[model samples]
Target: MKINIVNPDLNELGYVIAIANIKDKHDTSAPSDYHWKILKCRMIIFSNSSILACPDKNDVKQVHIIFNKAGDDYDKLISLFVKFSLIQNGGIRSATPEIYQKCFHYTMTARIAPVWNTLQDNYLINNRDFLVTRGPQEAVKYCIVVNDTFTVIEVNAVKINLMLTEEEFLPGEWIRVLPSLNKAIVEDSYKDFSQGSKFKSYKNLRRHWKNIHGYRLPENESAYYSIQFWRGEPLLYPKQCVLRNFPIVIPTSQPLEKLIISRFVTCLTSKMANVLGTKLIFKLEDIQPEDSKSLAPKDCLLETQAVSLCTPTQYSRSQK
Candidate 1:
């Protein structure tokens, strides 16, 4: 039950920027569950510079990006000539990215793996897609300018229009807002007997569960009866917003081990706090993208239910 971002001014520091309508933590009303009923209104902005894109001031929307961070790094090996495209989303409980093309300021990226020498199924499922390789353009590091105002984010089916990060490309990721300990899931040493195999429950998950630091996420509904809010449709915004950072480009190099043993880094809010080196603090004061319904807290709004993911009786809280 944590969510912080106090005294931020220096562009906004590192970055994660939020604006959720959050609520799809599962329960797809059951037809087979893949209909995704309501969790739209999103406005994410993870950073490492490449700043907000898609708002062609006069024309300059070029694509091809790939300097990846956050989530899966898997111990290095996908620098295939290095690109730098740009991008968004709703929720996903499971595969739904069929996207072939739709247009409106486009940018495509590709580099999935798992080909263990292709002995067919001998090395167990390994035939990932998207591998359109290319090289040279001088390997552009990062750059973006044109910020007068821009942010529309419709999320669900898709609705773009970004251009709000004035300038950034520093050494990002050592943000501090503190207050966060209380994560008990434990159990890690990585094992997997692989019998009926649902990954044998994947060794109980523990690539990073942080567990402590300052504090701030309460905002009504009694803080969800005292910790434990998670289902997955992207929650955690609780209140007091006001950020504007966009510095990024962390790569001193060190993280590697990750062949997929349930690293589960982010279901939107298990960002597992206690950070400093990895860089990705979250916030966005003045609430852009039309202020995102005031970021809720009309006293939790229950009877009428106008703000969820936490006040509608809790539904997400796993930043660790």
Candidate 2:
């Protein structure tokens, strides 16, 4: 358990708002597993209000703003705020090389869990001026501080969010600490919670997650993705998705049969990716009749089988 030797050079980068661990999803089995695994240098991004975050380049490439000050990237910054305001902590499965180029996320350390707060706060937590200051552990020694421009509303929101985090849930829903029994299991594993946590298996955890907390664990992979991308309703595509009512997006547009075998890897695997070079996704609004096939209807696309529209592909296997 060795923390990053090289600290992030804050000379040109923005203040450190968050930090990521440098380990695989399956790395954690002990409390101290996180500290040493964190690489600080990778997080030192050159941005306006960038927060220190993400140890792996594959997890997060650049930084987003943290304050409410009027800047060119106000919306962008607030969006980050919104993102953390409602993020998932536990996950369904594991995927290698998580980033944008990949798809989905199945990490144990997904958000401000009690274990997360303990590990991170062990590094440090103090408000030099206002609400709260959580920079690198060096922030305190260097007499550093958190953002100063937080409004009363923002400060209250932060307090509320923190409270919710303490309770072990994300914002806009519920947040709090789990029972000691549950926490015992949750903080242990970084991946593969389905292995059975003191917290419980997927069935038990999912049940407690919903019944006790009043929130719902995504049963549908697309809904899981929905929870991943935006903490809103899942935007499931009929064919691409695997849920009876939701979508299950893969890393790549893989075959229907493959989804079950790979357990989500080998293509659109269960992963979190930071980079997807030059590919962008835009949420279409009022789609018109003139849209392309790519812009499939958002509504449950239903129609009677018109004909055998099947056509053989150029692939040798398809011809057979």
Candidate 3:
């Protein structure tokens, strides 16, 4: 990666331009897939009384904060706190690109899972151009991270929601997780213990349970288990993501696969940024995979800088 300083007149602007090549060292292919990526330097635009600060940028073209080098951007932020570290740390040395790529990959995978699962599970798939992939990897990253918990629950609705509605069952009815009765008394025993009565219909029962009780589990069994209501949607293995089957070649062979991968990476990156105590602002750019030929052009690429302040100023907020 080479660092380019464009607009020297703005050199005092406190931003540095760092460029690096991302390569697939794991692949023994002759050229070893590679791509040139860029990062904009940053200055502390805002800081709180204590430890963390929200960094901002003057350039809005980039999507993610580029560490230029690689290796746990999450961890990299930590070293920034060392005695004297303000964006320009040791002049941007070279390191592993694996972490950046993985971070992006995981993030994208996590985000797309919910939507994909929704389509597959509910059999409600559509391509009305209603996709939620119109932002930088970093921004998309946060969207997925913040929204992942909700998406997961949506994907696995059955295990989450209560099968019966207050109206479907008598007002004072109750059903337990166990097929057989527990020593626990149902103060509201008016309800039938039969699974059939627990839900008015399998589909509605599953949806209701998901919406109402997605986060809390029934208080009966101690052992871990996955309760399947119906096989309507194929189950996604834990830790398995939509990008698992995506192609390594640029300009991915599969459209859906590429989309899933890109979304996951962008989302996960934002998640990591939040943990690092930074507010990530992202801009989305479109570059076809076939057109990507630097090193290993990532499924999703991010050009990130930091934001020091998130508070909406009178001028900015009023414009809205």
The root-mean-square deviation over C-alpha atoms between each candidate and the true structure, in angstroms, is 23.0, 22.2, 21.6
User: Each model's number of backbone clashes?
Assistant: 26, 23, 31
lDDT per residue, candidate 1, 59-164, as tens digits? 1221112222334321121221121111212221111111101111121010011221111111111112101111110000111111212212111110111112
Q: Considering every candidate listed, which one attains the maximal lDDT?
A: 3
lDDT of 3 by residue, 38-131 (tens): 1111111112111112112222221123332123543444344332122333343222232223233233232233332222111111111212
Q: Rate the local accuracy (lDDT) of all candidates.
A: 0.18, 0.21, 0.23
lDDT of 2 at 287: 24
| Evaluation by TM-score, superior candidate among 1 and 2 | 2
Segments in model 1 whose C-alpha atoms lie over 4 Å from true places: 6-266, 271-277, 281-293, 296-320
Pick by lDDT: 1 or 2, better one: 2
Question: Would you estimate the TM-scores of all the predictions?
Answer: 0.16, 0.20, 0.19
Q: What lDDT does candidate 3 reach at residue 104?
A: 32
What is the descending lDDT order?
3, 2, 1
Compared with the true structure, the alpha-carbon lDDT of candidate 3 equals 0.23
- Write model 2 residue lDDT over 88-154, tens digit each, in one string: 2232122122121111111212221211221111111121121122212111100111122110100
Task: Judge candidate 3 at residue 290 and give its lDDT.
Answer: 60
